[model samples]
Target: MHTLFSSNILSPPPAPATQQNPFELLFNSAATSNSTASASNSSAHSSPIEYNLLTRRLQDERRATEDARHVEPTAVRRKGHPKLLLMGQRRSGKSSIQNVILQKMPPTETLYLESTNTVKTVSMQSFAQFEMTEVPSQLSIESPEIAYSEANFRELGTVIWVIDVQDDYLSSINSLVHTAGFLAENYPRVHFEVFIHKTDGLSEEYRYDAFREVRQRVQDELSDVGFGHREVAFHQTSIFDHSIYEAISKVVQRLLPQLPALEALLNRLCSTCGMQKAYLFDTASKIYIATDASPTFLKDYEVCSDYVDVIVDIKALYGWQQPAKKPAGGSDADDEGIGESVVTFERNGDTYIYAREITEHLSLICLMGKGSGIDKRVLIDYNVSLLQDAVVEVFKV
Candidate 1:
């Protein structure tokens, strides 16, 4: 049998020299692991690495701000966190989107979600830590002092404007246009994201039509206002399916400063390992942090995301728990909380899906085909271990 990835295939081409060259770091890490593999053959495997650099940095910043002044704790926390502002017209499904996606509330349960009367902020504890603030629809954009003063759009990373597709959405589009205008004049750096939400009940044809209509209206209106060049992203989402998750994944990725490096790394990993697709997912939130540059098909993303759900369910159902461990200081705060799962299925008869915990919050899910032969599994694992180490290195403060 022929090997899928020849030794020569692993050598990556020279990338522009950044201060921290990811390719150089990846190869060096892989070499070091290979050097130690034989010596540690009989030794117990060490605990998996935990990636909490972002969280730790935020905590440190919070502490620094607290020591310097006497400000509201909430305001201090908001200063450093990646802020996701959710806005829409009254009765639009903004709260439902947050409740279902971030809070893990069931789709049907969102029906009982009382309308958010005030600005509500929730801290998202994920690989990319952020705060999601939902603005009440009743708050009008015409009054900047009232609405703009409270939300502090200058600090926002993304503004997600939700529009209910099933309702009379013309007014919703108008509100989005006005909001975009306000942001354009004052907080130009904040990214605008529109969610045509609650489309599960619409027919397939209507769903597509509604998506196009909302997008076109927003574009035309924005252009009419002189903010024509402003970039605005649009997505059709529903709490009932994986669309919302996929949309949010794209949004969160925009907030990651290391996105280019992560994408470059995934591209190298896939090319070197003979893998079809690879996603660095924030497992706790089911949002992919990055993926290989290869064209992404909907079916592939759904399968990989669903596999994460399956792993989580199995762990919960089986009550899989790690052995208790305490550090020298007797504190459990430093636990790595690592896990892994792998399954090969016959999608096209030779496909394999592999999920390995990259950190306390991140997991790498890979889709491979015939190249992942039984004999070559060891080689593939070695390459993945290299990816794990390189990823940790990239996130280093």
Candidate 2:
């Protein structure tokens, strides 16, 4: 006696009309027809089954995604990205360093820069393809919100401590000592660099003395703290001259994991091309990321670095503005137009400075002696082509 509704299914109940009913005879026989109703009920019942299958499929997919996430966790840091931290006491040229080096601001103009009361970071791919973070002078390692926490220190490649030479720097040295000791013990991978800054006002002899004094004090203090084995690099810097650029170039080189490869490639280029020296420069920052294995003379580096500026300046005036083509490889920022320049100038009739574009944001500047294959532009270009391809491979730009 049970009807279809007695089961768990949700199909609608049958209508009450029947063929035996007397009302069926009074109504038109054609109006009683419902021949397709069984097919309709079957299709309607199949919908819920299909929906259940779809729901199960979606759940399986979500679970698989979670498993994959667990198998390969998401990365917290980007590959090939390093951060350079600028830290020191107030008015120690930390902010000025960023302004002069990254913003192309004049050294004199930095005098008017307001004090940074909070941590600030300037991210640039054109500047060595890394981030430069400036820590407020008031913040210390003990500050709860200090940027040098263990988590952040793990991401840092180098920390440049700027000490104003003209000001009383003893307190600065003390702070640097404590900070360095802490970091050296905790973050052994991070490099410690000291910049004897604002030396534009000091005489040559005083500069040397100041540099020695700072080095000695740091070494002695670190040794007393039982970290005598720790390595710290010292550089004399002034925004008014090329010293800052040179120091920064060294810092950037240390951060590069492929520096040895780049240097070896440059050595090959220099030897095969009979060039005295070769520099791979970051176009925007005027910082040479790599150079030949040969000893680097400050004068030679200064000349080469200045040549980058000269080429860019001349191009700014006369270089054609063509749509910038995609670079071979690297994270150089996109530009509206490509600025290309090839410059050669003879110095004292002995050294020929040749510079040309290697990539959108990189330049290869070479110093060739007279008769060192400078006149044969075609051969040099071929060798440089190989170098360009190799550079792209090395940086995987």
Candidate 3:
């Protein structure tokens, strides 16, 4: 589950969720192998077809999870949520990335987030998906336990190394070469994607030059360390804009096996509603989990993202950003208020934007044509209902 600005778990998580965060949540509606094995022991006795279904469902659920905290690696590499280690020195914007994606912390709030002072594995309560750890600079990389653990070499999918381009560079480069190059030689399968972080403050020329010069230096260091074989993808990332979220979304989409099915459903919704496009966005981060197959132009994505920002801003102002101030002896429904909205406006032309509640943390955003007649409104509402039903069915799995 995606957490809100200042919280982690719900009021009370369900069952085992309190003790150990289960990885599978609405984000990962499907189940994972480790979870399934742990869920029902009797499942193992099922037939081949049944087992196949179970495995696929587990994998799907793993992908659906919004964010998972890191767990200590055991001697053996157990099947679990794929690991994503935020590797960088102090003040490299590592926590910003984690808070932005995991806690859904506002970019501004991240400025005040406390610096991680120790090595700790953070996991969600409702489910434990893949593990994530904010690897601070002070970590002892030379520790034999961590270096010898098979899980360290086999489980990680990506190491998001951050480079604070505006900061002192010589020390960061040396650390990058020693740490990343050693892993490249052993963990050839692990991907290396670097972020030239905090580039929003740089001019275009500086941004390009910084990106290029830093990337080349890292590459040269890797080559010197005999890790030049594999390519390292680089990005200019900033928590202020949608750049980091978009980059993380691309990294995560590769892990979602249910993505095609979700996209197909969105495509069907678009056709049925006669809308231009549809997106299932992770509400906190404002990143679209899935979108219709219609080719996405930069302008279209920007428009949808901006509309989502408006919805969030309104919700923050008057909606459920905070718990309702209930009357004494309040009824259960009293706590439930209107968290969804439907509004129409002009942008290039008369446009209709409908925001529907998908989950407590997810929402459906759609782009409708200029028609505002009564009949057109009904059609839009009708299709939205269908879309919700489909989503419910998806969650049932």
Candidate 4:
């Protein structure tokens, strides 16, 4: 709730003013003298000199104080979970897979072309007891403006490509491959997961055969693009099948260990902002942190220069007080400026409570040091426990 700006400069107090009456009398006298002198020197000298010696001295001192302040290089060690992106053709069961993984149906529907126009993000606590972000197809493909925003892609850890096994559209395959190519080109270091969704639609015999064929097609396409078949992992999934859920759990277990901290930071922000989804803007980082919370206080949150790793709260902005009210019909709320809270923490810094609420979901983003060099999965598990405790505290208060 508190943000500290570390500045060495101590602005000087204003110069003491002389007694008003006395100062006025002196000014009057000076003016009279100056006028008389000007008349006397009219034929010889020009106007009397107007000097502000005190003002000049004050300005010089202020500049010197600013110059004296040092710019120390401080490292920011952020500790959080990974960002996961889900993508696939229309109605490829991407949302269904997300529901299975998150262990809850999305507040919205999961159908063909249901997300034809926008991208959606779901924040959840996985069975693995780790915080994970599920980016649905709506927000990924339909809304290009939001999808490629700097905030959207910067924290992304893994891109999960879901495919419907029952749909035999070759064009869908091409689109999927192209999407992968685009992502790989943009984010070479990010990991990937290709899910063959809707496995329940096919019979046991056809399911296995289709799964194998889909895997082969993905492998061939990836290989053709020079992305080795081994680089990607494939999964056969059906939201109705418990076994599919178990398989996904295993995949997440293996991948969770490699997730980065920014992902966790984002999930916390989304949950706090009450935004069903958000796209990141890199330029916004210049003024604010890379992540965004919904119900945007303004259109963006800026970074506070006082602290190297601190984001400025929207309330602190020059003009950000009233927030926009939610629209009727339970539609998503529009982001105004930045939200009231600012998320700040340093890597290797002391543990602090960072919590926010989006609608009913409460999340806490914490920073952990390298004291133990703990495994990534282990770190996530620990943070999830901390988040739950923090949420409970929010309700208690």
Can you write out model 4's per-residue Cα lDDT over 333-368, one digit (the tens) per residue?
Answer: 134421223242457333322322222222222222
Question: What's the lDDT for residue 57 in model 1?
Answer: 32
Ranking by lDDT: 2, 1, 3, 4
Sort by TM-score, top down from the best: 1, 2, 3, 4
Write model 1 residue lDDT over 6-43, tens digit each, in one string.
Answer: 23222333222333321111211233333333213211
lDDT of 3 by residue, 238-260 (tens): 88877787766655554443454
Candidate 1, number of clashes: 0
In terms of TM-score, the best-performing candidate is 1
In order of appearance, the predictions have TM-scores of 0.75, 0.74, 0.62, 0.41
Count of clashes, each model: 0, 2, 18, 28
Ten residues in a row with the worst lDDT in model 2?
A: 20-29
Candidate 3 deviant stretches above 4 angstroms: 1-83, 100-115, 123-131, 140-149, 152-157, 168-174, 181-185, 213-231, 267-277, 293-340, 347-349, 369-397
Q: Write the per-residue lDDT of candidate 2 for residues 79-186, one digit (tens) a residue.
A: 335678899999999999998887789999998999999888887666345678899988886676665456777567788999999999999999999989888877
Q: Model 4 off-target regions past 4 Å?
A: 1-79, 106-116, 125-147, 258-397
| lDDT for 126 (candidate 1) | 62
Better of 2 and 3 by lDDT: 2
